[model samples]
Target: MNTIKDQDLSKNQLLVKNIVEHAIDQANFTIKNLSKRPTVAMLMECENCLTDFMPVVKFIADDHIEYAPIYDQMCAAIDAVQMGEDLVEIEFA
Candidate 1:
């Protein structure tokens, strides 16, 4: 199972990760035109203890849908790795 094992992650971290992931997914599904570009605002939060991690809203995507999705996916994957088991073994399909 895909997951993250963040030993030092607070609740806010998890929240931020979730929001970013959701935004990325939404962008992928909602945005159609590659030229139009899709943007998403994410609120960062703690992982272990839910809290206001950051005050400023994080923005994803500028004008390149392809790059945005790739970056988002990488960020999400990294976050998952930090939150999952200490010894995570992923099997890509």
Candidate 2:
């Protein structure tokens, strides 16, 4: 992916980034308070929200450059949540 900074984002890209950030933040929040590993069904709402933002990320900028980190954060959060890890503590790639 190409490199794109936060300051470089367009209006549309910023909007997409906001939604994706919300998805990841909420997902992390849900898992952070839990004491046990989450089942996929347990994370269904967060997962669904994240999934819904997938297509939006791809359109955020040329080659989806500006939103790559958001996409990565979503993937990492989902993986860690599904794996019973601390979503808030995990540093997404």
Candidate 3:
């Protein structure tokens, strides 16, 4: 017999799995498209893209951390590029 906790766990796992799979797909696509071997700058560009998307994911998937292994795996896909000052701060004029 399934409990409420079991159902919630299942939902979290599915959410994290979907996120991890998407992250992996994005990483593979970035790796494939490099004109030259990927440089730190190029990878940083990819990281920038990921960071741009992260806020939206965080908002939508606030519950996702309950299934951390999959979340970590998603993070690992682009792990090499650390968040730095290059992530722009937007200013409204």
Candidate 4:
């Protein structure tokens, strides 16, 4: 028989998996729609896309300390996109 701790862990794992997959799909959709826009606009939209899902990632990290790396990755990815936007602005604007 599965213990209570085991059951809780399984549920958390499923929740994390769903959240990550959904975030990936959401980002992908946003990126696909942005492809025709200007480079700067694309980067800005991408930043906004990541920003929108960041809270969900944070929520996961808050409840599941073991998934902190995923949260860190999300932060790094957002920072990189913001940097790209800054570079594009510097180069063209």
Best by lDDT: 4
Which residue pairs collide, candidate 3?
none
What lDDT would each prediction earn against the true structure?
0.34, 0.58, 0.51, 0.65
Q: Write the per-residue lDDT of candidate 4 for residues 36-61, one digit (tens) a residue.
A: 46476777787787798878878877
lDDT of 2 by residue, 1-93 (tens): 755565556855667657656655655565554435456665666556556755565455337575677667767766765665666532333
User: Comparing candidate 1 with candidate 2, which one achieves the higher TM-score?
Assistant: 2
Per-residue lDDT of 1-93 in model 1, one digit per residue for the tens? 534665445754666556655544443332222213322212111121112211111242343242354454444533543454121111111
lDDT of 3 at 7: 70
Error of 4 at 27 (Å): 3.3
What's the true lDDT of residue 7 in model 1?
45
lDDT of 1: 0.34
Best by TM-score: 4
In candidate 2, position 16 carries an lDDT of 62
Question: Candidate 2, TM-score vs. the true structure?
Answer: 0.50
Candidates sorted by lDDT, descending order?
Answer: 4, 2, 3, 1
